[model samples]
Target: MIEQDRALYRPLWTVSFDEAVTLVRAGIAAAMRHQVKDLLVDTTALRGFPSPGTFQRFLMAVEWAEEASGRIRLAMVALGEMIHAQKFGVTVAFNRGLVNNVFTTELEALAWLDVEPGKGSPTRRQ
Candidate 1:
């Protein structure tokens, strides 16, 4: 977890599924306290598989945070074990359009946050 320029950047959090919820809760607190507008969560470093409960709680926290502050932008990069979490039954069901956020590679994720989506990207360039 890293904080830069009022933006909280979390490159990696943990291997334990339960720990992930704690970390997310912390991140949400930080974001709320700082009134951060940009939140970058990189799950590329996740090592172990997270259970359905973990994913569910994580999503719940995110939803809560977003509802609390609609201006906050969330970017999540899923890879490896984290990708597996995306495939979990609950994740699959509730993951769609969770946010008006962007899904892309690390570089693209940052770029997406830097610029408004659908303004220049393929999704918007059309």
Candidate 2:
């Protein structure tokens, strides 16, 4: 789980596909309760091909986020060798509308999400 100062930012959590769906659900609930406007999801450390079940969970999470408020933005950071660019591209295509935006660098991601650096909302995407 990723923590941040509540006064300046919202908390971000890292989880595998197995845990992504659940986390997304909880995140949506929290966002609603807390009126969070931005969310950064760091997929930099995510490695390996997910099982069918995990993939399904990941899809569910994306869908949930999409259906929720458009204020939330997901920053998916793909670390070197952790995930292939082709696979990441495919996933991005499929979830284009699910997330506000995606990026390969933490700076770009934060910029796309309109998050200021050093505010505890650092997340990268591939």
| TM-score, every prediction | 0.56, 0.48
Clashes of 2: 4
**Ten consecutive residues with minimal summed lDDT in candidate 1?**
117-126
Best by lDDT: 1
Give candidate 2 misplaced runs (Cα > 4 Å).
1-16, 45-58, 80-99, 115-126
Candidate 1 stretches with Cα past 4 Å from truth are 1-6, 11-13, 51-68, 80-104, 117-126
lDDT of the candidates, in the order given: 0.50, 0.47
Instruction: State how far residue 25 of model 2 sits from its true place (Å).
Output: 3.5
lDDT of 2 by residue, 1-126 (tens): 333421122334555655654554565556546655555555555433453343563566466555454444455444545434444433542354444444556667556556453243222332
Q: Could you give me the TM-score of model 2 versus the true structure? A: 0.48
Compose the digit string of candidate 1's lDDT tens values, residues 1-126: 445533544646445755664565566567667766666666566556553465564565455444435445555565543334333422332243322232436676676667753354222211
